[model samples]
Target: MTLPVDLETDAARLRAIMAEDLAVRGVLDDPAWRAAVEAVPRHRFAPGFYLPGEERDGLGLTVWQPVTAALDPGRWLAAAYSDTTLITQFDGDEPDWEHPAERHGGAPTSSSTLPSLVVRMWADADVREGHTVLEIGTGTGYSTALACERLGSAGVTSVDVDPYRLERAASSLHGCGYAPTLAVADGVYGYWPEAPFDRIVAACSFRAVPPALVAQTRPGGKILLTLSGWLYGYARVLLTVSGDGTAEGCLLGGTVSFMSARTHAAPAFGNPAHWAAELPGEARDARHGPERITAATEEAFHLRFLVQSAVPGAQLATVGDVVHLVDVVSGSAATLTPDCEGGWRVREGGPVRLWESVERVVDVYEAAGRPGSESFTLSVHHGGQHLRHPRVPCLPLPSPEGRPGRSRTASGRTGHSSSQLARE
Candidate 1:
């Protein structure tokens, strides 16, 4: 099939778009980042591609279009340069370029995180010239390329759990005339063959910072990552490795979802249809009761997050007026009854009550004045302990002057202010 645009022209156009977009957004002003953006050709990274408007049943459709490799250079370039996610692995496996049908079923396992998020994380890492860096989740090798542009190819080492992805990314990087030490290994272990890294960035999110990553960095080196938590949103954090290997840094911005490192990937919950059939009609109805809050633009995303978090292994479907939350962990199914009025009810499971959990999250959101991702704060302890709040100090509160006052931090830490955290 003939594509509408020439590859070189598309590549040039992509560079122009990215430069302009980042310039307008204030991300391209950093000369290092700007250089990296200019040097990487997104089309070379995504060999098989599809245009953005193409539709397929699931997430698989986006990754398997080799023809797109020639036709839609802009889509590939946009995906490459923009701060939006490009799905790389679906359900823990690399997409089979030979068979698109296999792409369905599992959730997204890896991606090149949005360009903006990567830039923010790089800024948080505070990487300097000649810094040795280790990047987790090499995906399409786009971010690795950026790191190479900043730190030099010799100073970077990139790793991923899937050997196929690593191999493919190695080729992509090589085609671009840049090469870093690429390895097929579990990212959770941190690549120690080249240890004492000055900076470490995880392209994937994790419930906790792997102790190995902290231990592998030089004292005072920065480790930037997305801290995963039960809350719907995640926090981009910057932690400094101490001589003792313990790390501490404050949250940098809002949240993003990334495939958990292989060791942390959530176990499969099994077939959804079977679980739906097993749910009791009453429990399902109660969970789907009318939503009490007004319908707002942000409600859908938050609602999806809460439902997925509350009902692990469940699939959520919104069909026009009704929302369906289905869980099929054991070939047994339960569903939440949809309330056209915006309420929820669970029609399955014993007294565990999935709907109640969702309602609780909704109540929290309402109490917080329906703040979107920006209004939340997340903090994590060294051992993976975490807390979330709609406001900050995250604990005991005091006035701006540091005097003990009636208002406490939402999470209650004294002498802390919520103003320190920013949203991405």
Candidate 2:
């Protein structure tokens, strides 16, 4: 295929814009990263992608518009360099046609993560010359290309579970004039042949850090990944592997949403136990104080992350004003209903009161001062992982004086006004 001169010019222009955006956001301070961002032609890798659209049906599925260079070259080039995640594969399948009249709707199984986020992650990983980096989930090879540019092709090894993705990424990397070692293997196992990697970064989120990844990393090496689960909450963590294979690290300040590791795609929220559990004999009505406490946490992302972290395998769902808590492993279920007068009614079923557990944890989080994920530390041991906070710290709340659209000061410690919480 012959290259179009105008397309190359447009791609360069867009790349510059993306670099500026990232720099303004304070994520692209590294000159080498900026140079790589400008040098690589992103459009070559993402020849076609899906633009997530509205839900076409009531099943909560989103309609995705497929953008191809042939169909609309201008739009395609624009999307290629835009600072947003581009869906590369849907429902684990690639689009069959170059251009289709109708749109498709399904979950995104692969994507080119937003350029800014990718660069931010690279910065967080602290990739440097001579560092042997192993990247998990090389979806479209865009990030892989960046790593190769910064660390040289021989310094990076990229792996993915999908054979098709590996083949496509290998082709893309080659076209861009760089060929990093690409492998088709389960990322959870962490490419054992390339053991003792100096740095490991995962594009996919994990319910817990894979033991194999910890084992493969050199002692004092950095391992960056997101800890996410069924509830869809996330905490970016950077752990330092110990000589014994145990890693301890705290959550990064902000939350990042990434696809769950293929091997750890949590069980369905309706895990059979929720249906088989028996109801408690009598339901208890939570008092006003507890009601307010529970309601306050409903819209707080940090609090939700903390709750999900403490109660592994716990899932939460909300309908109208009521929130449901369930634990499939223990066959426990609980529901909270608001009485519209500052109090909530609680119902318990199964072997345990899941809502009570959630409530107690919420209290502990509150007592700790509602600290964000940054305040919590995770210790991954042999059997399981443990999340702990040294002191009860309050999460940085939205500023009370600030309006809905206004930004706050450096210290992010303002609580949202009562009205804002209610509206949410």
Candidate 3:
């Protein structure tokens, strides 16, 4: 009863709208980036996605329903061209084939990342005409397509841990007339076969730059990755590898949280018995005012980084006025509560005196003028990587204070649990 819609005209209109939005915000300034954005047909990559409904469910939960070309082609194409992230995969839950109309609920495991963020990272990587770019975490292959359009398909190499994703991406890339190299491998190790890459950009986040990534990069090559911690705080960095095998760079201002690399994810959290096993190790009292670091504000960004650098693998969860800190590596846990007086009380356990370190680091950071990301620089060595600032003292990457023998996956490779990792 209905004629086929003119997809090209519709896609072009939406692309222009996206470009205008980016230009007005001063994000699409690079001619190459602009050309790539305009040329690539984003709708080809995301055949189906979940869009969160404006209304809440009876239980006050956000409703996310799938939209596909068969269900609603026009709306689907519009969303594909929008600037928002499109959810492509849900973790932990599988679709119910019996109830085809049912909507599944779970954490978003993969997605088409926001276009602006992707371009920003590409810009930071300094991807140029003749540069060979190795893109880690090739979700949906949208970024790979962009790189292929900007440079040549021969200059782009993309790798992802999931073979299923790589297969889908390959089809999408081929559909768009791009045949960039696609590999099914762990991004943590980077692709050694494609070594000496001029530009390396990771769409995923990790606590530290993998030494292998640095070794595979050509001298003076640039690397960009979202530097994230278990605290869930993150910042972007673009480091230039030197002949000495050290890459130093400053953190880009503004927060960015990507799915943690699969190999870097932590094990099961929220197991009551897990915490119960370590509660009898130690007990501690108030060390200092937790508000000096726990208060949520723009200024607290540096303070969060301070705690992450000091404690290594600390994760934070706040309930009411109390902040809970747990380290899977060290089995250390601490509960910080605001004291009636303007100070704070700390109850600690396990081998690590996390509260004492927090107090000491806060003092040092404050004395150093509470430097921001601009003052922070990364120094990646073969042994480890440490974040340093001119004003704040150098903090070496601490041993991942997690439980030994619990970090590796069944494949006998170093891998984290599903809880601590995401791919999209």
lDDT computed for candidate 3 = 0.75
TM-score of model number 3: 0.85
Could you tell me every candidate's TM-score relative to the true structure? 0.69, 0.84, 0.85
What is the C-alpha lDDT profile of model 1 across 1-424, one tens digit per residue? 1234565766667777886788689876788787777777765666553223355565444333333343444555556555556666666655555543323344666666667767767777888898999999898887888888788899999998887888888988887789899998877788999998999999876656677888799988988887542222344667787786566666554435566666654444545555556656554445224343224334554444433333333344444544444433322234545466655555655323444555655555566676554444333344332334544212211111212122233345332122122222
lDDT of each: 0.59, 0.72, 0.75
**Top-lDDT candidate index:** 3
Q: Judged by TM-score, which candidate is best?
A: 3
- RMSDs, each prediction? 9.3, 10.2, 6.5
lDDT of 2 by residue, 319-370 (tens): 6676666665544567776777767787776544555655666676666676
Question: How far in Å is the alpha carbon of 79 misplaced in model 2?
Answer: 1.5
Q: Once superposed on the true structure, which residue ranges of model 1 sit more than 4 Å away at CA?
A: 1-17, 52-66, 69-114, 228-235, 243-245, 252-255, 276-334, 339-342, 361-384, 388-424
After aligning candidate 3 to the native by TM-score, how far in Å is the CA of 27 from where it should be?
0.7
